[model samples]
Target: MPWSLHGGSHLPGCPGIMEEVDKILIRSLRLSGTEIPDEVQSIREFTTELIVESVVRCLRVINPSVGAGLSHILPPGMSARFRIGMSLAQACQDLGYQGEVGYQTFLYSSEPEIRRLLLFLVEKLPRDASEDASQPVGKSTTLHRAIAVAIKEQLAVPWVPPACRTPRLQLLQGSCLLKRFQAQPLVLPWESNLVPGKVPPERKEFFVKFLPPVSAQLPQTTSLVPSLLERNMAELSAAQDWESEWKSQGLGSRMTPEEYRQWKLQRLQRRLLDQLRQASPSLGPAQPGTTGRDLIQLLGSFGAGHERAGALAKGSRFTHTQNLAYKQEAEHPVQVETIPISRTSEQELREKQAAELETLEGELGRLVGQIGDLEGQMATLGLTLTQVEGEVRQRQLGVTEQEQTLRVKGRTVELLPDAENNMAKLQVVVESSAQRIIQLAAQWEKHRVPLTQEFRELKALHNSKELESSRRLLEIRELHERIRSAADEAKHKEDLYKQLLVELESLPKDVSRSAYTQRILEIVGNIRKQKEEITKILSDTRGLQKEINGLTGKLDRTFAVTDELVFKDAKRDEAVRKAYKYLAALHENCSQLIQTIEDTGTILREIRDLEEQIESETSKKTLSNLERILSDYRAMKQENTALLGRTRET
Candidate 1:
């Protein structure tokens, strides 16, 4: 019904561009011009193409280098199409002939237009020009003729051209003003001579209620005069007959003698009934809707109308049915609702598990790596110890040879390996040094037992932690899997809840499904959140387990140093040993303290996360949402609170 086509031409360049897009849109849309008459469609297309073609034509005309523009003097009696073409050309030339076209050889040639504006004007117009430049010809005559033809053809009427005569408009000056008045017609009671007959007693009483109070009797006046009285008497007689014509007692409710007589008959009937009751008294029982019944029953019988009366006449009573029959026929109504969940819960669980598992495995691996490092250091220490032992053995063997040498030649040098008896002294010194080394090695061996024991204990602790961590990791993983499964199921239920929500949201206004859906959604959301939090705890537990395992490894390495303490050089190594022992003790204590802090921090964070989950899970939007979902789920249709004990025990 709305015409959207932009028929006026502001179309630029080739019309082909718009034509192409239009064709595509038209074809794609499968739009039909069936609603438009063939003539209008043809006209629309023709105008559109004409406008487009005209633009092209104007552009061709304006591009000329020397000739005057064709639009300068549009032909007299030109068609609208031709005029439109001329305007198009002039517009293309950018409001032609505005300021100046200076004779510049550099810009444009100065050759005058072969068909100049003056020549074209004189040729096109049906007027003669005056010598004075301002003197005018009848400029609008040609345009007027064209307009006359267009108006005649388009409007299908004889073209009555606008009058050229100078016209004046004035208000008519006169005193003929409309007076404000009301027309009152005296409608005489006897005007139409519709003198109505007396209404029956029953209808009169039925139609007119609230009878007038009884009034005291009144007297009439006497007449005077003789001949005047005689003439007056005849006139009075005529007037009395006329007065009967005008009289109307039907509009008034003052009872006539007949109506009064009927009312008195009704009272007489009531008194007769009472007298009969007193005399005989043993009557049949009264019935409803009979004359004996009260007015209210009569009205009520009519109020029920014919349908109920007919039903009662038919004797189709609604008697009690068997309890089993009632139960069998009664409807069993059931409602099913679902819960909602986050879409990414499954993926989140997986990601958490992945990261925590990586951390756990990484820590265990790192402990293994640390053990390798400790082994490397121990290997180097062992190699150097073996070298020291070898050198000490070689020197000790040389000392024995020297002692043998010293026994033969030096008693004094043999005593303490002094330099005096060189070989003997060297032998004794070598023996002493070897003995010190051996004793120290023995002490080192003694210390190695406890150190090894400590290391074994630490390793056992590490193994225990690792086993427990691994078990916990398995549990965490299983929990993750379970949570993932639960989460997925939760999501499934949640999706169902969302679907229910969408259905509920789409339900008719009066349906109870929305409240049911909202309640279910809240429950689902809480469960999903709880699942997510549980998954997170599993993730955190794995990571903390890894930290404990790492601490165990560190403890093992620290205890290992105690093995190096006991040696022949115990006195010399006392400070070094104590230092090592103190360092281990300090590291172990720090590890335990840090582990506890980190564990507690992790726990608190988890608790806070859970609390947030709880808050989010409970969507306390409106009072109804809260009451229907949480505070009182079963409450129905109540805007205000009910008595407390009225809640269902279930």
Candidate 2:
């Protein structure tokens, strides 16, 4: 048997394995007088080294002597650096790995490859050690090898934890790891040769000879290692010694490999129960009703108890049928009771009829309201008809009174001939005025003819006088030219006389002064006679022009009077024509008035006949209609009574 490490059972698994390995290393290092101030850091360093060494070992297993496989262990993009002299952390870090933390993470990695690698190391390392020691390896006298083989075959294919593997495989793997605690000569480097196997020579072997001899009996069965029968027998024998070592209490000899496995499983169960208790401390004893049932349930969980019937209390009220019903209730938590289809349909028909009845009742209410409104309207129409009848009678009385007044007016109208005579006398007076107007017009025409003739003669005379005045003006202009020429001649003669006097003064005593003086006096007398004659002619022409202007004014006045008389005669003729047109219009209007009177008499006779026919028709139709309305009203009342009875019955 291998010496067990202290606190090995208390430690859990993978991480616990790491911690145990670490403690061994620290103890060894401390024994060598190497003080580690921070033990955890030192342990991390050692674990990193172990991980790197394991990788190298795995690589060597692929191919010894470091061939192309060595490169496979390097991080993908790592340089081909020398790892021989380098620390594991430094080498791993240089390879782009996270050194110690990465090694721990990889050890617990969920990757199938990492898991396989770790298991492979655990399996190979101890077997290799046993081989080196020249000891029997894997030759145990037990059935574990077959079981381990079956488990390995079942878990041959890699799978994610808790999802793919069967519970049996999980239990086997767990048991196998627990079994590793008994491994001889611990496989970790720090633990090698540290645990001594034999007692020291200086110590007395007090219990060695007293210990029981080992048994050479083969297992009773080839199929089972530590079957339940053997385990129970061992437990019974061990019951007498409470303080005996659990390992030593085994039946076969001491704790056989099979008994050790059984004890370990029990211990694991105990740990689970303790943990469950810690998680829920209020887990009390089973209730009275469930205690016996729970005992049966517990017994049923045992593999061998499946064929046996449950044990029950003698006075218990439970039965197989009731248990089956309870089981069914548990399976289907909510129960739904079903009803018959006929009942359901009847309920639905009742609901539909109720809804229709409610609708009919509402319609009846509306009809009643409408009937009340119609009755009120009929009352109003009746009152209005009576009022109209009274008004018509009053109008008839007023029309009769007006007709009497019209008869009185007709007698007065019979005296219109006297007024006609008066009108005829007025007409004679108008005729006489017309004749007088005609006579006056003729006299005015005669008077206008002479004036027109006189105006024509005066116009002719005025034209001749205008021509004579123009001729006289031409003669006066000629006289003015002659006078101007004579004056110029006289001025020339005076200038000649002055020059002659100047010559007379410049001449000798022989120059003729008397001749020059005689010439000057003759010229002066001639100038005076010419000027006086021109003045007389000019005065005579001006007098003739003034007389001609006076005659033109007189002629204009005469023509204006003739124009006024002619305009008055035209206006009077227009006024007489207009008066004749008015007389013709009056005669035509009188003829139309006689025709209108005849038409009015015919229309009034037709209106009286139509009114008599309308009264006869109205009297007949009103009596028939009133009889029909009374019959309809009585029928409607009977129908309403019948409907009310039907509604009440429903």
**Residue 283 of model 2, lDDT score:** 42
Clash pairs, candidate 1, are 339-494, 399-427, 440-568, 443-566, 443-567, 444-567, 451-563
The candidate that wins on lDDT is: 2
How do the predictions measure up, each by TM-score?
Answer: 0.15, 0.13
Off by over 4 Å in 1: 1-508, 512-515, 561-571, 591-650
- Candidate 1, residues 1-650: lDDT per residue as tens digits? 01112321122232343343233222211111112223332221322233223223323333444223333232322233345444443543362433222211101111122112212222222221111112222325435655877766646633332442222111112223333232222222121222247546664564455343212111111211223345445657876664343233311324554564456556665555455433322233234434334323333434433344221222211221232234433543223222234644667667766886786567556555665565567557756766897799899999999998888677754555545677676789899999999999999999999999999999999999878866775675577568768988988667656544544454356534355446445544654676698899999989989998897798677666654543333557777767766766786798799779989999999998888656534422234334434433333224223434466432
Worst 10 residues of 2 by lDDT: 180-189
When summed lDDT is taken over every stretch of 10 residues in candidate 1, the lowest stretch is 105-114
Model 1 residue 187 lDDT score:
20
Q: Whole-model Cα lDDT per candidate?
A: 0.45, 0.50
Error of 2 at 180 (Å): 99
